[model samples]
Structure formats: C-alpha cells, structure tokens
Target: MTGEPFKLGDRERDEIKWSCGAGLGLLTRYAPGDFTVTLRLQPENEKRDRLDLGLLRKPQEDSDIGEGHETWVPLIKNVTSFEISYFDPNANTWLPRWPGAQLPRLVKVKVGRSDTAVPWEAIIPLRRTPY
Candidate 1:
C-alpha cells in the first residue's frame, strides 16, 4: 500500500490499549467531507473479518458504547459487496455484519476480524451528500 502520512487523535490513538482492538498505533482526526482514512490490518489467523463505521455530527458521549452525534454507515464485504449490503458492529463482535447498501453516507470504518485476528487499520472516505 502507499505510505502516506497518517495522524491520530488522543481518542483514536487510545484504541491501542485493547489487544483485541486495532494495533496500528497511529491515531488521526478527520472532519466531515471528502476524505480517505486508511488502516493497516494483519490477520493473525483464519476467520471472517468485517468492518464498521460511524460519522458523528458531534462528539460522542462515550466512545466505548459507540455513541455520538454518530451517523452509521457499515462497510462492505470484500469491496464487491459495498454495492449490496452494509456493515454493522452492534455487539462489538466480528461476525454477522456487513449489510451492504448502495451509496451510503460513509463516515468511519469498524473492522471485525476473525480467526487469529490481525491489526486492522481502517480507512474511510467521506461521501459527498448529493442534494
């Protein structure tokens, strides 16, 4: 992948604390607009990995519960499913996700890794609202 400059915020950077969470160790801050947030994922074993995303209109009350002025847009399965169903991480589990939809208001990405798991870095591009 292309090695572009990446930045992390205090909240985003704090995800490293959990061994089950993303371990890229790079935190970043992205505003609402056209953006591409990328993450690095190295799977440790063989399992189903799905990603989730949310874009908050405002800061979240609690980051763990996945709250905020958050607008949710799930990820696609294997880039091919992006035009189909969508992604969801309601229980923080890695399975039974990806309900792909055509043209979503994509804001963030949540990765659900199965098997041995890996360090998954999420990259999300902000979608322009076609009014």
Candidate 2:
C-alpha cells in the first residue's frame, strides 16, 4: 500500500493500529519537525524472518505530484534477529539531516527481501565550534 504526503496523522495511526492483527503493531510519532516510525512483529515461537525498511523520496523533476520517480534511501536491511525495527529522522548515524533538502516523503517496508544499496547524497555541513 502507498500513501502520499507521508505525514502520519492521528486517524492514520488509528487505522494502522486497527489493521494490525494479534502479532503486529504500528507505532508512529512526531518529534519537532521530524517523524518516527516503529514496527513491532511478534511470533508465537522463535522462528522469524528478515525484514528491510527503506525510506524513499520523490525527485523534484517528476511531473506527477506524489507518484514521481521514487528512490530507495536505505534505512536498514537484512534485519533478521530483531523483532522490533524503527526509523527516526532525528536520530540516525547513517543519514544526517542537511540544511535545505527536505526529509523523506515516503516509506517502504519489505519482508524477506533485499534491494540495491543507494548512498546518501548530501554532506552534513560543518558548524563553528564554540570555545
């Protein structure tokens, strides 16, 4: 399922919670200007499978508003052992937020699958250190 504008409001959160069955839960929250997403998967036994979480962005050049050329900005991959996976735009070592570019506008979750790695484009600008 694909959703546009990528903002998870209260109603969307409620729907996600209701749609989740006995062994699943979806948690979302906003921190300042950024958002956080967490997926909880519970199984009866020890058996589990790997899951990949990706953040995609639409290119500015695309004509379609929400259905533009989507690119995978790899968040986490080959996550086999962890039962809980989360993505927080504010706190991540892999991709630091830049000054002008916008945050990811889309999220993609894949189970037992892998995609080609895409390197983050922007470089974190250096700030002056206070003495």
Candidate 3:
C-alpha cells in the first residue's frame, strides 16, 4: 500500500475505541491489500497519560476468541512502528499479505493504558502484513 497520512474523524476514532473495548480485535476487509500502519501518539492528550501497543494472533477461528494469544513481543509505549507480514513457506520468505476476497479475520491490538479512568483497548483485523 501507499504511505499516506489519513485523518481520523470523530466517528472513526469512536469506532476504534469501541472495537478496542470490544476486545474482538479490528476486522479489515477494506481494499488495498498492502499498506502501512502509522499511529501518531500525543502524550499530552488529556484522556491518556501513556499507551501500550502490541500484536496478538488467534491460532484458530473457532477455537480462540477475544484476544486469543499474546505474542512474546513486548508492548511499546509513547510511539512505535510495526509492519505486518505473512510467511511464504514455499518461497521461504515473508511477504506482505493484503485484504482481498476472503473472510474477515481479527487482528488484535493489545493496548495497555496507565493513569486513565477509561480503558481504551482494541484489536485490528488485518488481511495484510505491515511490510
């Protein structure tokens, strides 16, 4: 996908909040299989003092539910960058997986918050990798 900066409206931000709270992860069946995930964190935001971000995977569709499993990777605070990619077993390399004609899957974003009255957690359903 292209490296472009997009603005999030109130509704969009609200949706993200709901999804995070829902704990089901973000489901993305949108277009453009390949893309970049960029989050600009402003620590000065009144709602939150710190934010933790990480990736989680659901091993199986029917078996796992709600934040299936947390990867060994540690969550990051303040600001961070990540790329989602799929392992191409045949090619013996990792490739960028994009959303196409496939059932929507949940990509969980393990969010940790501190010093906030309201907890904003979210999961991202990704059809592609970060690349």
Superposed on all Cα atoms, model 3 deviates from the true structure by an RMSD in Å of 14.5
Summarize candidate 2's per-residue lDDT along 1-131 as a digit string, tens digits.
21122213211111011122122122223212222222322222356444344443333345666654543334455533221122234564332222223333222232332343432222322233233
Poorly placed runs, candidate 2 (over 4 Å) = 1-53, 78-126
Give the per-residue lDDT of model 3 (tens digit) for 15-118: 02111212224234432222222232333346874423433322332234454342222236653222333334346663334233332243323222444544
Please give the CA lDDT of all the candidate structures.
0.28, 0.29, 0.32
Query: Which pairs of residues collide in model 2?
Result: none
Which is the leading candidate under TM-score? 3
**TM-score for all predictions?**
0.18, 0.23, 0.24
lDDT of 3 at 5: 24
Q: Quick one: how many clashes does candidate 2 have?
A: 0
Q: Report the CA-based lDDT of candidate 3 relative to the real structure.
A: 0.32
